[model samples]
Target chain A: MYVYNDFDETFVRTRVAQFRGQVERRIDGSLTEDEFKPLRLMNGLYLQLHAYMLRVAVPYGTLNPAQMRQLAMIADRWDKGYGHFTTRQNIQYNWPKLGDVPDMLEALADVGMHAIQTSGNTIRNVTADHFAGAAADEIEDPRAIAELLRQWSTDHPEFQFLPRKFKIAVTGAAADRAVTRAHDIGLVVVRNDAGEVGYQVIVGGGLGRTPMVGKVLRDFVSKADLLPYVEAIVSVYNLLGRRDNKYKARIKITLHENGIETIRDLVEDRFNAIRAGFGGYDQTLLAEIEKSFAPPAFVTKATDGYEAARLANPAFRSWTDTNLSAHKAAGYAIVSISIKKHGATPGDATSDQMRVMAELADRYGHGELRISHEQNVILPHVHQSDLPAVYAALRKADLATANIGLASDIIACPGMDYCALATARSIPIAQQIATRFDELKIEHDVGPLKIKISGCINACGHHHVGHIGILGLDRAGVENYQITLGGDGSEMTTIGERAGPGFSADDIVPAIERLVTGYLDLRRDPSETFLQTYRRLGLAPFKTLLYPSEDKADAA
Target chain B: MPPRFTPKVVTANALLDGDAVWLTEDDHWSPLMSRAELITDEAHADLRLLQAKARASEIAGAYLADARLGADGPEPVHFREAFRTRGPSNYPHGKQVETPPQT
Candidate 1:
């Protein structure tokens, strides 16, 4: 993890003090609510449905044990006893008071974290693959570039108030774990014909009211020129992106209105005009940042204990099968501790759970933890020989759920429960589905399905990219859910297609059950996943499963 | 034809705590939605909302939410308003901590 230098430390503390003054002004009526709204949003404070929510950025989803412990302290002191890890790989406190936010931010700054740029129209926290450094297939750690972007974008004067909120994601592996194509700008580290590593810049991809897969703006931008090239794209977007309507303000719409070719030419022109001024400073900063992310020394430990534990304990074996990922180092594995326990709210971690995770990170994970965009905690450097001990500790804390890519490992936004913009409650729906599938004892059978739920069209849950997407909406003043099928957020990104009409909140779980159970019958074999089956058979069979009555009528 | 106005309550999030609060008949903000003054007339509802909005230091995002005059007090007519009255569905926090949801 990147430790804050004196400049970074002072910068964050100054902002916290400034925000404290602003809070006081707002309370004393010196600043009107309208005036303070934008300021509060800039600091990642928002008055939601029932309470104020504070979103703190975990830059590139990286955290040390100290930072994680501080987050637990903030949750226990200023807000509720738990925090909601969002799909953006940030944590949100759902019950923060208006007066307590400054204090919460102060605590965050003490640990080299902040709520800055987590909200508002500025470039939000730059997300990267959760397993960036540890993944076996990775060419290079993406978080180094991500941290560089975080430094560049934080309060960048030229791009602070863009047409709308912009998001960027980076991934080093070919697997695209960060959902790269679903962001405003996506960077994939690739090797060129000359075997030189550079970024494949993707532009204009976004999910929301209008979901679009990003187009390749440039095939390869060298490490020396990545900053200038990214700046050129954002600068072009700053001028040309639509601001007349909030719905159409994103660069995706801009790319749609003006052709990508035109945008590409403009970006190239801007890149050339400003490329000289960069003068290799970014590369120097990147080189410095890369030093902090160097992989930990691997211990040459015996794996006999790990193999024995797996043989002795079926539960531990199942967990290892699902929650562990291949690590770059031979003796190590990336452990994804599922925050999504059966029937629990997805992405919520109690203060105690946070502390336990911090302790685990300290003891077993080289003092490193990662918050995946899928809303799970990653012990990114756990050795296989220590897996049994880690699993034992996790089990004691109820963190050892063996459901990483299963139906129950859902990604859900805090719908009407906490969000002011939500149309319906997403938490209960996610809970019910996970609980139902767990009760049926078929989550493992369902296998490798991504069920993402968003309370509204904003797609905060990335429902647009789920294998089975559930979008909650208010239809005639009642909660209704719409289903989308065959969406995949991977190297081959595809936007989900909506099935016909909506289902009532009561019917949605059964509808999903019918669809998944139906999928079991339709798949060619066990190896054929939900997404593959949906792709092969298309929407007709799934539509029938979702609306059995319509199928019956058609047959009749 | 003009649509009939629904009975409404002036509701907003309290400025300090940021929890849902409603304007009572005594003009004091109460966290309990049951104590809210339900305005049957559209003109009165609009006026109450305007007055609620004016208390900038006390509240934020004040608006008229649909409600009904129940036997005991005002009850939220929409699910969203009902959720505001009692906290989130997933946890028994917020108003639910003080007074558990009645069925």
Candidate 2:
């Protein structure tokens, strides 16, 4: 993990001090709500439907054991004994009191974390693949670039307040685990024909009311020129992005209005103008950041014990099969602790759960942790030999529900339950669907399905990119849900298309069940996953199944 | 023809704690929905909204919520306001967790 230096520490402390004074002024009748709203948002404080929410950035989804423990302490001390990990690899405290937020910020700063740029119309936290350093197919750890972007954009005067909130994601692997294509800017680390590693820059991709797959602005840009290149992109957006309408303000809309070629030309011109200003400073910084991400040493370990445990315990076997991923290091595995336990709040972890994860990271994962964009915690480098021990510890904590990439591994936003912007509730729908699927005992059989739900078109839960997407809406004070099929957020990113009319909240789960059961019969074989089958056979079959005619409905 | 006026209440999140509170007949914030001042006149609703907004130091994002007097007290007519009254259904937190049963 990247440790904060003197400058970083001082910078965070200064921000906290500034926030403390701002809080005091607001409470003492010096600052009005209007005056304090933007200030509070800049520091990651949000007044939601019920309470104040404080979002803390987990840079590139990476954390050390100490930082994780502090997060647990903060949850227990200030929040309601739990925190919600978001799809952006950030942790949110939904119940922090406004008066106690300054203290929370201070505590976060103590452990080399801060809530800066976690909200507002500023460059937000730069996210990377959760399996960055540990993935077997990685070109390079993308966190080096992610950290550079974080430092450059934290309080960058040039891009402090853009036309809209901008998001950036980087992935080192060929398989896109970071949902790179759904971000405002997506950087895929790819090697050029010359066999030199560089970024395949995709610009204008975003998921909100309007969903778009990013256009390839530049096929490849060398690592040395990455910062200046990105700065140029943001600069172009800052100039050309619409200011007249808040809904049409994002760079995606800008890119849509003015073609990618024109935007590319402007970006190149701006790149040349400010490219000299970077002065090779970021290259030097990148080298230092790369050193901090050096892989831990691996020792030869026996796997017989792991095999024995798998044979002895069926639950452990099932968990390992679903939750373990291939690691770059020999005899090591990337363990995904499914925070999305069946039928509960997705991405919610209690203080005790957080502590157990911190301890497991310390004992078996080299004191390191990574939060996936899927809302699960990752022990990035666990030795295969220690799988039994990790599994046992996790089971004791109720953290061992093994539903990664399955039907029950659902991604849901806070929805109307907590969000002021939500039109319909999303959490209960997700819980009911997961619980219903578990009761059917068909989750494992369904296999490799991503069910993502968003409260509204904001797409915070990434509903637009799920294989089975459920979008919650409000129609005449009643909850209505719309389903979409064939969306894939992988190397081949495609927005899922809506399947006809919406389903009421009550009828949604059964409707989903019908869709999935119909899909099982629609597939060529069980080997073909949901996405594979949907891609192979178009939405015609699924559409008919979802909204079957009176004749077809009676036949069933 | 003019649109009929609906009963309303001035609601806002308390600045210090960020919990939902409503303006009362006595010009104070009460966390309970039943204690909220029910406004049937449009002019009075606007006046109460302005009065609630004036207390900026004590509250944030004050606005009129659509509600009506039920058999008990002020009950939310819209689902959004109903959620605010009882809190989120996913968990027993906020007003639902700490508040006593409705009279």
Alpha-carbon error at A429 in model 2, in Å? 0.8
What's the residue-level lDDT of A325 in candidate 1? 97
lDDT per residue (tens digit) for residues A315-360 in model 2: 9999999999999988899999998887899999999999999999
- The TM-score, computed over Cα atoms with residue i paired to residue i, of candidate 2 is 0.98
List where candidate 2 sits over 4 angstroms from the true fold. A549-556, B100-103
Going through the candidates in the order shown, the clash numbers are 0, 0
- Stretches > 4 Å off in candidate 1: B100-103
The sequence of per-residue lDDT tens digits that candidate 1 reaches over residues A14-39 is 99999999999999999989999999
The DockQ for candidate 1, computed on C-alphas, is: 0.86
- Cα deviation at A313, candidate 2, in Å, is 1.9
Docking class of 1: high
Question: Can you give the TM-score per candidate against the true fold?
Answer: 0.99, 0.98
Candidate 2: Cα lDDT at A352:
95
